[model samples]
Target: MRFCILGLVEVQDERSGLRVLPTGAKQRALLAALVVKAGHEISARRLIDELWGGHPPANAANALQIHVARLRRLLSGPAERDADQPERRPWIETTGHGYALRLSPAETDAARFQHLTDQGRRALLHDPGQAGELLGQALSLWRGPALQGSVLGDICADEATRLDEHRLAALEMRYDAYLRTGRHGEITGELVDLTLQHPTRERFYDLLMVALYRCGRQAEALAVYERARTRMRHELGVEPGPALRELMRRILHHDPALARTPGPRPADPSQPRATPAPADDAALSLGDEMARLHRRIERLQREQDQLLRCFRELTASAAQRDMSVNWEGS
Candidate 1:
């Protein structure tokens, strides 16, 4: 039997490869309570608290036992449907005080995800390619939010939150791996979704800005920084983090290091060598455009100065002519 908590609380029969989860609320709750702490034995009192909180039934212990029995029967695989031969061994074994669900690390998706992420993190510094592979595999296991369809108690809720955080960290790590390999264009869309999904996360915002800047969208990258700064200020009453701020500064100055990767060589040998390739062409066009705009602005400024001078000279000449006319009349 395999337990699944990545998406929902479920038990899948390995032999038949079919989900055989209990549908009742309390039964699922009991299973979840045990599955959350798979290896260790949870006391009956704690199980009661987790399942029913402070409002357990008069025969709460019996109810708990009944739920446990249902879970065990369901966990006994496909043979539980057969009346001829009942499976002797139960997944949930009764201890002296309460019970313990026997589950290997690979048996639960959550556990497996955690294990893969841990391995990925360890491999990150030494082998980013392997790290990305492992982290990608780890992230692929998540179908939705932790315990997607199940009602979470305090313990489960906390565990779910922890799991979600781990998932985010793994995602960021995987993205970082991609960034290291100069695959920023590929991850920009995904990073945009992540930033929208987690608006407060500066790391996502930073990655988005970097990706946009690397893709030659400097203005858009700066806009993203401004949005993040504004949101942080208006919502949290704080400035952006150091990393984001530094990236903004780099973008503002058009740091060459950000685009250190050389652009593709131009094709078409017959074409004039003057025209740059796509990436270099963008940078060259921006520089030439800025220079042309600067020249136009300077010329406009000179014309305006000349017009002001002409206006002043005409006004002076008219004043003198008025004075001469006034003197002749006097």
Candidate 2:
């Protein structure tokens, strides 16, 4: 039997291919909370607060008992269906102060998703193709939002947010693996979808820019950087990070390394890949770019001085004209 909270809170019976779940909102919430801390007891106080929105009824204990009983019956009833399957029968356990669900990571999609994502991320430098496959498997497990359908309590909401973040990170890792394996062109459309879905996520823009440039759309790649810069500044009220800015600079220079396909390298696990040795030519190019920037900044300062002078002249003339009109009237 598998208890799934990756999407809806439900139970899937392996033998009968039957799907059963809690129907009421509170019941579903209870099941979700328990499943989040599966195999461990969650305090009755916390469960009560979550189940009742921090304002449980006068007889909250009895009400909780009713919900628990219903869930137990829902999970374990129809004795005939589970007579041969003892494991499928009786999943929820009552504790001295709280409740626990007798479940393991093998039977939980959420656990499996996190586990696979971790494995995929670790395999990135050593085996990108295999990493992509593992990450793809992890991503496929998400049916929708974590703990879908139930009114998310604090515990559930936090878990859901954490899971969603892992999902996004896994996606970035998987696509990064694809790029490392030189399959950028094939994933442009999918990356576009991800960019649209997560416009504020600069990693997607970084990936898109590389993919576009590799597809011989250098101009489009630069355009993607511009869009990211504008959106980041306007919406996020900040500039793109240094890594993204460097990527843009590399694209502008048509960095040969960006175009070259990267080969699989052994991962260290203890240390990050070392930065490439700096090139003198790159330093010279950077000097030129910096010189141009300084020139542009100086020009802008001069323009600001000119605008200030113009504003002062206009103010003085207006004042003089007003004074002359007053004298004529007098």
TM-score: which candidate is best?
2
After TM-score superposition, the amount by which residue 300's alpha carbon in candidate 2 deviates from its true location, in angstroms, is: 5.0
Cα RMSD to native, each candidate? Answer: 13.8, 7.6
Candidate 2 clashing pairs?
A: none
lDDT for model 2, please.
Answer: 0.81
The lDDT per prediction is 0.77, 0.81
- Model 1 stretches with alpha carbons more than 4 Å out: 78-88, 260-330
Summarize candidate 1's per-residue lDDT along 131-172 as a digit string, tens digits.
889999999988777876555467677788889999999999
Worst 10 residues of 1 by lDDT: 272-281
Model 1 global lDDT (CA atoms, 0 to 1): 0.77
User: Pairing residues by index, what is the TM-score of model 2?
Assistant: 0.79
